[model samples]
Target: MTTPFGLSSTATTNTLVLGQKDLEIIQPPDDAISCLKFSPLSIPQTYLIASSWANDIRCWEIQSNGQSVAKAIQKHDAPILSCCWSEDGSKVFTAGCDKTAKMWDLQANTFVQIAAHDQPIRTIHYIQRPSYSCVMTGSWDRTVKFWDTRQATPLKQLALSERIYAADVFGPMAVITTADRNIQVYSLDQGPTEYKKIESLLKYQHRCVSIFTDKSKNPNGFAVGSIEGRVAIMYVETANPSVDNFTFKCHRSTPQPPTNTQDIFAVNDIAFHPIHGTLATVGSDGRYSFWDKDDRTKLKTSDVIND
Candidate 1:
């Protein structure tokens, strides 16, 4: 199928064209790929990490030819739902239905179950900066917990009213999405001592499905996506003494279609471009569109991926 924006190709290519283009899909192992993270270092040798619904974590080396070939890595009994590479790309962290978040030593090719979450862990991220090296996790248990990777127990757990679907660590703040249709932003800089909820925005019926911060624009601000096909730009406002001061502006809305207008169909994943200030969203409808901050117009729409 072809659209006005660009053509969709199923061919696998080792090279990325100067402009936006489709990546060849190298059939991932078995089961569905639940999460994907690319090494921040370089392209080929950098590595792409994928966690699966099949209780597996696989690392594929970006070959010299730009092709991805899966490397056998750690295997677990429960599905690996979410995974992330450390800031320095030295380690990998994964959370899963096994109810634990494990750390992988890339250099040693070993796995260590670092912290156990009460429920199926949905997301895990490592916070590394000038002052600390810690891990944060959000779970179906309706809570977010911070753990000192060096310790056996969690440093702090913030109770919530809904199950957490996803979370991201940015600088000193952590942005979390809940099943209750709220995006809860928390401060990681406060450590375990005291955590005041930074911001809570109620905007959807199916939870904030995805959230991504623009690494190039306002690295501190982020965009939230919900199941109902709505995305809002959320920014942290720390001036207020209590948390939850963060505010949001609706950036894009899935068109109540048949209107001959293009919009996000149903956001499944979102990523900020490597250089541009554009935010890319991939949806269940296989539409890939890029948008700017002001939400003025859909900047670009490229190839669509049909599942």
Candidate 2:
């Protein structure tokens, strides 16, 4: 299907292709993409939403044949930095350089300002628990705010030492990375208070982070990526010395036979498979790789694509 932005390829099979032999290129935003999120598992249809530097958010419904249909588009005053799908996949939450966060209801086709910060909202997430539900927004103003959509003001706000670079929340655990390479863990069950704080293992600037469950289906560990082409696997429970916490180098190119030098690229993003728990990392090298964190091995690596 051809869109106003670009032409999209239609796949023959129902499976979605990414960095594989048969790739499907959908309509892209006018500027660089800052964030991309897929619909929650509860939703039957696969919907992808992307926030871009062009100050707009675009949603696409993935068809059975890997075709992407433009579902919705919402504009913002400034570049959108991040976006996420609600637990039920019925709504989307976005935050950006405009210092505000907005919620988009897919069913009603409406947008509402849900939260605000003093500085650019860099990251956002929707948190839903049996006892409570709210939107989490992390901003460059060095604060993390939780907002109840029904009310105008934030339900809770947590101040940090430095500006937030990235954050991720899973189950009741929240991991936040700041500008100074400081990592803080929060327990939602304990009311937004700081649970434990740890210094990052990587020496370079942190880029992205993701939470993954352990064998018991509890979120006890998380992956942190840095600009130095490294990922650190950390566990929340450090009391157990038996737990394996390690860091590995990736997204780097080996030098030729005559030279021992290597080219290192920043690890742009890291995500763990919801079902299998395997991790995937995308980098500035234009390559993505899947890894088995427990086994400490790369499962698959995709060919470099020319962007």
Candidate 3:
């Protein structure tokens, strides 16, 4: 079976290679899992962290034998919508329905809090440079805010036209997709002032965004997914720009029996393998797919997780 590490396993005793029942499974939270992220690639051992709508957060160390043991878990007052790790893996940032963003000490289990928005936060991300680190958040409030590690107040908050549905950062550039079907890009170094809005269609509501970072220090393009099962592979016009911007259909829905209509589902998440630049996407259909972006090809699609 294909392990999550992007490798095949020949070992018969590997639990991750076994059926779901054979693997070490953490007790699931009462609600849906909202986000899942791995520990920093620089770390010796990989850890999988998951936050859920049950107002719970948990982390588990991924064992070499494909098993896992819980390392930490905490319960909050409200459901957590998203979570991300700090640059050094020393802190975990979580945002939720409570309209607050919190920084948790990974080892100590203590936390500091910030009132981030008037509406529930939908996403949170952290990126660091040699000189400074920043945590960014996107909210249903139709705003994206950036906070420097040293300050409690946001350095800047940019007003988005519609509710922020998805946002992502790669190096100095970031992309924000809103409810109005606007896909906007920003320069992290330029704070909230420098941004460009891409002119796209009004058909699909963006569900997720991911930036490509393998080839260049500052990659020019990003991929965004929509509720209609399409993915937009967009390139900016400057560093400043590029010409190969396009969008395609992927993770399509199935037609209902005796009806022309099909069940539409949201693309839940998108990520590029750090080393390979291969893109992976997960959808509400419970299927996961792989794409070779450089080749503009669909590499493979897995059966629904339940199957």
Clashes of each: 2, 0, 3
Give the lowest summed-lDDT range of ten residues in model 2: 4-13
List the pairs of residues colliding in candidate 3.
Answer: 237-240, 237-241, 238-241
Better of 1 and 2 by TM-score: 2
Top-lDDT candidate index: 2
Greater-lDDT candidate between 1 and 3: 3
For residue 253, give model 3's deviation from the true position in Å.
4.0
Give the residue spans of candidate 2 off by over 4 A. Answer: 1-21, 239-243, 257-259
| lDDT at residue 232 of model 1 (Cα atoms) | 58
Which regions of candidate 1 are displaced past 4 Å? 1-21, 25-27, 42-44, 192-202, 205-218, 238-265
Local error of candidate 3 at residue 91 (angstroms): 0.6
RMSD in order of candidates: 8.0, 4.0, 5.9
CA displacement after TM-score superposition, residue 221 of candidate 2 (Å): 0.7
- In TM-score terms, candidate 3 sits at 0.86
Per-residue CA lDDT of model 2 for 87-143, tens digit only, reads 989899999999999998877778889999999999999888878899999999999
